[model samples]
Target: MRARIAGVAAYLPEHTLTSAGVEARVRAAGGGYRPHPTIVERMTGIASRHVMRDDQQASDLAAEAARRVLAERGTGPERLDLLIFGSASQDMVEPATAHIVAAKLGATCPVFDVKNACNSFLNGLQMADALIRTGQHERVLVCTGEAPSRAIRWKVRDRAQFVDAFAGYTLSDGGAAMLVEAAPDGGIFYRDFAAVSAAWQVGTLPGGGSMHPRDPEFTYFSGDGRRLKDAFVDNGPEIFCTALEKTGLTWDDFAIIGVHQVTMPYLEVLRSILDIPAERLVVTLPEHGNVASASLPLQLDTAIRSGRCGPGDRVALIGLAGGVSLGVIFAEL
Candidate 1:
């Protein structure tokens, strides 16, 4: 048995924050230096991105996507045996956001969460695949609500700081849901994950943690972009090629390659490293920005819906996160 994606849906908040809007905000915040809005667009390939309402919770976004997926599949929340809310953003610190999403949907299924920064959704897919293959679960729902835009620090004092925080500027708010059910065969066939603890400090969301619990002002996300790029560039090929080797497949085998939507240049880097053809890749970062865990499903669903991918197409999911972790999943649609 394998875990197959029966349906998938995505929800983007109504509010759109364009690159110009972000630039205006930076200027209003009295930043001594602000990059031109077009600079962000040119570098990150993001013209605009969704932003959640101030009053909305992450669970709200996840529920909306989940509702659509369930409705499309003609399945009720009550029929799901497991719910996994995988995201970088949560409703709260203690209670899992999955529980809140379940409550919103009036579901009584077992609920939990899986967190791996931007790779959360891929990790959840791996877990769901294992459970369904072993008969522990029949129907599982994986959902993500990402709002990294909320963590942007608009008060940067220098160009370097602004550049370091550029990742946050590219962050968008959205939700995506996928319904995974047991299949007789031909679902997920290969998966791999690698964690580089040494490179963990390259990128981070520094806030509300035990080490710096008192720094209320440190809620903004930051990263050494050049360092991250260098590290990934140095090691990315091995990471991706190993997964292809494990599956006895090559990059040419996949019909559509869905990668975590971080930035345009980074996606190009991945393309160069893996030698992937332009047509074989799905590019969503330009319109969606970096929706974190919701990115992969959103890209996958968009490709499928747009006729860019068809039934029995081999889909390759590649995820790279702030933790400097890489995960890959190969599945047949």
Candidate 2:
């Protein structure tokens, strides 16, 4: 038996924050260094991003998406043999967010959380595939709810602080869910992942951990965008090339290729490096910003709805995270 992606769904909050609005907020916050009004849109090519309601928690978002996926498949929560909550943001630090999501969805299945920055969902899918192939589980639900908006830094002290907080401005709140089930048919066939652990310091949200348990100063997202970009440029593309070599498959073979999109320039850079065709991509960065772990699923859902990909079609999900990790998963729908 193979683990196949049976269904996928995505949820985006109604509220939106435009790049111009972000600039206005920063300026209103009385920051020491004023950013140019067009800087955010010009630099990142992100016109706007979604914002969750103040009352919504990470579990709430995940549950919403999960419900849609379950309903679409005509499967109840009880039918899931396992559930995985994969996200960079969580409702709290004590109990795994998976437990909360399960409770919200009325699912009593075994659950856990997987955290690896933006690659959390991909890792969850990898784990589910392995478990199903090994005969440990028959069905699995992998879900993510990212509320990076809570950690975005609006007030900057100076140019240095603004640069450090730049990545946060590109973040958006969203949720996604994918159901993986055992099927005697085409499914996930190839996967490759590589990371530069030394470059882990390139980006971070330092709060809610042992190092800064009570420091309010460490509660915002900060990073050096240039360094992060260089880290990927130095260590990324080889994984994709190697996967193709091992699988004897070329980029054109996939009907739809969903690559994690953070910025237009970086997406173009990766596309050029890999020689991926323009039409193969589902470009969501401009409107949705970076939705963290939900990005790949969002793209897949979009492609499926638009008839870009469907049953018997090959698909590729390429992931890039702040930990400077790169991953690729090839599957058939």
Candidate 3:
């Protein structure tokens, strides 16, 4: 048996924060350095991003998307043989967020969390596929609730701080769920992943860990965006290119290719590198911002709803995370 993605769902909060609004907030915070108007949009190509309500937790967003997936499949959470909560953000640090999500959805299945920066969902899918192929489980729910906005640094102290926290400005709070089940026919066909562990310092959320357990200063996200980009570029696209070579498939073979998007320039760079057709790509960063682990699923759901891709169609999920990891998962929907 193979693991197939049976259902995909996404949820974005109603509230939006425009790039200009981000600058306004920074200025309002009485930071010493004042940013020029439209700088955020100009640099990142992100017009706006979703913001979760103050009362909403990461589990709440994940549960919302999971509910939609369960409803669409005409099943209940209890039927899920496994649930994986995959995200960069969590409601807390003690209990795995998966447990919290399971409680909210009334699911008693075995659960755990997968954290690998933005590639969390892709890793979760990879694990689910392996487990199903090994006959350990029949159905798995892979979900993510990313509230990166909660850690965004609005109080910019200077140009250095702003540049370090630039990546946070592109983040948007959202949730996504993908139901993977056993299918004797079409399912995940190929997957590849690579990472440069030495590049881990390129980006980070330093709070809640042993290094900075009580340091309020480490609560916000900090990173060198240029370094992170350089790390990926240096790591190269062998994972994706090798997949195509080994599978005898070209970019055109996939009906839809959902690449984890951060900025328009970077997306174009990757597309050019891989030679993916324009029509096959989904551009969500402009309006949705970078939804972290939710980005790929959001693109898949959009493509399915927009009639861009459907059942029996070939799809590719390409992931890039801050840890400078790369991944590719090709499947037949």
Give TM-scores for every candidate, taking all chains together and pairing residue i with residue i.
Answer: 0.97, 0.99, 0.99
Q: How large is the C-alpha RMSD of every model relative to the true structure?
A: 1.3, 0.7, 0.7
Give the runs in model 2 whose Cα sits over 4 Å from its true position: none
Q: Write the per-residue lDDT of candidate 2 for residues 1-333, one digit (tens) a residue.
A: 999999999999999999999999998898677898899999999999999999999899999999999999999999999999999899999799999999999999999999999999999999999999999999999999999999988888898899899999999999999999999989999888899989999999998789999899899998998899888888888888898899998989999999999899999998998899999999999999999999999999999989999999999999999888889999999
lDDT for each candidate structure: 0.87, 0.94, 0.93
1 versus 3: better lDDT goes to: 3
> Which of 1 and 3 is ahead in TM-score?
3
Best-performing candidate as measured by lDDT: 2
Please give the ranking of all candidate structures by lDDT, highest first, separated by commas: 2, 3, 1
Model 2 TM-score, all chains together: 0.99
Off by over 4 Å in 1: none
Q: On residues 228-290, what C-alpha lDDT tens digit does candidate 3 reach at each position?
A: 888877775878889999999998899999999888888888888878898999889999999
lDDT of 2: 0.94
Which pairs of residues collide in candidate 1?
A: none
Candidate 3 Cα outliers beyond 4 Å, as residue runs: none
